[model samples]
Target chain A: MTLLEDILLLGLIVTAVAAPLCKRLMATVIVYMSFGLLMAVLWVLLESPDLAVTEAAVGVGVTTILFFLTLRRIHELKGTKDE
Target chain B: MSKKESAWTRFAAWVNGEHEPAESRLFSMGMGPRKERRPEITLPKREEKQRLHGFLSWYPVASAVIGVILVGILLATVLAMPSFGQVENPTNNEVPAHYLQHTREETGASNAVAGMILNYRGFDTFGESCVLFLAVSCVFILLLRDENNTSQKDLEQAQRREQRRKRRQDVILQEAARLLSPFILLFGAYMLLGGHHSPGGGFSGGAVLGGALILYASAFGQDAIRRFFNEKVYNTVRVIGLMLYAVLFGYYIFTGANGLENHIPLDYGGLILPIDIAVGLVVACTMYGFYAMFTRGEL
Candidate 1:
């Protein structure tokens, strides 16, 4: 395999490991987002521009925003619990 | 030592006179504190229990039948492997290749993806966009409940009670959001219109616009946003968008032209107006509906 492919594979492995290892829920979500971003890059490399665009937009952009929003809501509920 | 011997003699006399020696020993052992007596084992008294046991005895038989069937399937798959491998890959070498070669001149679009989506498969795109609209409408209906008694009233009451108890902070962030919302909406529209030739499209643009509105609502209040663009207005726009798509497709069919045929008069344009407009409207409504549901925490 090419050096670039090997490097990307290593990065993906790290992301996979780190996602579960992250303690905070928000940090875990960020790691998952990075995983998705990497997958988009992989899709582009595989010569599927349409899929890449979709992954970047729906997977990374909209879904990440949704996750962040939900996380914030969870944080608010946690605050209420603390009170 | 004499008292202990006397007690043992008395116990031996009681055991010998009252019961069998084995029974007497068992009783003594059972009464000892170090161990507890086991309950007497009893046979099933109910007919139902006997029937259940009979039924359970067939479980192994059923498992054996399933296992045999699975083995048969596995053998069949193994035997069929060569035939499956020998099956020809269906080729569209003649028509699709010719179509691909002729597409650029016919569609007048630089991007093959855009041409394929907007021109070749326009009907499917229209249907998909309509599905999005339908989904958002259903979500809206499910979330909003009866209009006569809206959730806004409860929110208003809560706000009033909070205001009565304490002074609310004058947030500058809210004020800035309110100011920026219109520009965001305009940019979203531009993205929708320029989608055929540019990077941005209906879905992205609509989401951005809807997000901007959500920001405004959160900053000011739901009631404030509702005053300008209420449920009725959104519903109307959604219906209008769907109707426009239907009309466009209907026109194409009636005129004996294929659906998604570029009828729009633009120099070097591949976009049909109906698709762009329909997608834009659907995206906008969907995004808005999602935002409304999300902010209200219904989903």
Candidate 2:
């Protein structure tokens, strides 16, 4: 369990750093989402399943949709650039 | 007629990033005319531009060093703190013990965390619900489309987009949504209703429900969702959910504070179910409302 946690923690750090450094907004959002997912796993490891559930649902799910919508609305999505 | 330039208007202009005088002491002290331009000492423009370029070139390295230092400081702080989940830790107080021992009996919730949040520290949860409610209300105010706010060109553009979406709908998304939404909704209902006894709760469950709603909406378009959850129904559900939780929790607090024997029984987790449902309703609506408003500027 500790080993798995360590791996997840490392992944979290990587995703956190990569998110801001990503060139494309979509990639940044995706990396940020992976960070959320890793944090959810860490929450479960910490024995806070409630937090894990909320993190997965809110941090990963709703937040990603909102980000995508914002991207689309701003005409940042692919193929919308020409328009 | 020249507009009177008060501090408020000047501050607003500053916030909007409008061009301002390099030295505004005279204008700020209200002693000089606002429009007067004064020549002041300055660096040669070419030299200043070179200096700016030099600073800009070093900005990334400076920021990276600062980031590393900040991270090191935070890590050091965490390392200096005691290790996690120690028996003698400050968090292992009598308060947690008391909650653990009495939660099941007092709140009839098998889940101590749920009992604590929904019963003992209910006002915190109430405040959270209010925040979600307020968030959706703010989004509605900012994004809701109507004849007053939406221009004719915007309406036509939206119509064109809708038609385009209809013409090139993704069959796979619609089919997958049809296959998966029922199970997702069922799981959400289970989480909401079983919150008193399990790890799941109102917020998580409502978010799941909202996710399912968004998926269906994305697959099928606005017309299908509007058939059932039009503006009127959405408003009613959102408002009523918050009101229900507020009234019920307020009654509970009033009775408890006044030292009266509450009419509701805590044995069967009397208030937990209703409160959870109310919270779930608010959250689900808030999530869906955000998605709908963002996508179409209406619900």
- Error (Å) of candidate 1 at residue B222 is 3.5
Docking class of 1: incorrect
| Residue-by-residue lDDT tens digits, candidate 2, B1-299 | 23556766877777555747558774465655577678887999999999999999999999999989999999999998988889998889998998899787777788998888888888999999999999999898789897667899999988988998999999999999999988989999999999999988889999999988999999999799899988899889888988999899898888772224677786656788888999999999999999999999987
What CAPRI class is candidate 2? Answer: high
The clash numbers for all candidates, in the given order, read 0, 0
TM-score of 2: 0.87
TM-score per candidate, chains pooled = 0.58, 0.87
Task: Supply candidate 1's per-residue lDDT for B232.
Answer: 79
Interface RMSD of 1: 3.3
Model 2 chain B worst lDDT run, 10 consecutive residues:
B257-266
Clashing pairs in 1: none
